[model samples]
Target: MNLVLIAMIAAMLIPMYEAWKDDNIWQKMLALASISSKAGIMTLFISVLRDDWMIGVVGAIILTVGNAGLMLLAHVIKRLDDL
Candidate 1:
């Protein structure tokens, strides 16, 4: 595993732990957690594809934020389901 990957996973620790403790919408939590995982993977992907560090960094940021936003969307959907 890459060091960046390790760091990314470590970053998710708090969110994952908190989400697991949250009984409501556990699936939603898991989906959110997966966003971090995907972000790391996407970063690795872009890094290997491009020699440009700036592009990789920017793309990774965008992808990661988009992933988390999807998770937030899921949360909203779950809450709406409750209504």
Candidate 2:
């Protein structure tokens, strides 16, 4: 379980590095979305390991809603870029 959590944390860092290295807006947004997803998954995993329903619920919400908000923000940025 510890190894799995460590691996997940390492995986999350990849996107963070990409986001930091890239100057393009689209790439940055994609990287951020990836980070959000990984975070949610990590949270879910932690909740399951501890057998906690409240944390699980929060994880589920993050998994479902975080990306949607990011997508909406991306769309808004895209429109603004077009202006």
Candidate 3:
């Protein structure tokens, strides 16, 4: 379990690095989206390992709402860019 968490953390860092290194707005948003997804998955994995329903629910909410919010923000940014 520790090894799995370590691997997930390492995977999450890849996007963080990309977000840091890139200046493009779309790439940064994509990287942020990826990071959000990995964080939600990691949270759910920990919840399952501990057999906690509350944490699992929180993770599920993070997964859905976080991504949806990001998509909406991206759409708004796109519209603004076009104006």
What are the models' TM-scores? 0.43, 0.92, 0.90
- Model 3 TM-score, all chains together: 0.90
lDDT of each: 0.67, 0.90, 0.91
- For candidate 3, write residues 1-83 as lDDT tens digits: 89999999999999879878878778888888998999999999999999999999999999999988997898899899999
Ranking by TM-score: 2, 3, 1
Lowest-scoring 10 consecutive residues by lDDT in candidate 3? 18-27
lDDT of 2 by residue, 1-83 (tens): 99999999999889879878878788888888998899999998999999998998998998899999998999899999999
Candidate 1, after superposition: displacement of residue 73 in Å?
4.4
Q: For residue 59, what is the lDDT in candidate 2?
A: 89
Candidate 1: tens digits of C-alpha lDDT, residues 15-60: 6666766676755567575756666566666577666687677667
Q: In candidate 3, which residue ranges exceed 4 Å CA deviation? A: none
RMSD of 3: 1.2
List the lowest-lDDT window of 10 residues for candidate 1: 26-35
Question: Model 2: runs farther than 4 Å from truth?
Answer: none
Model 2 worst lDDT window (10 residues): 18-27
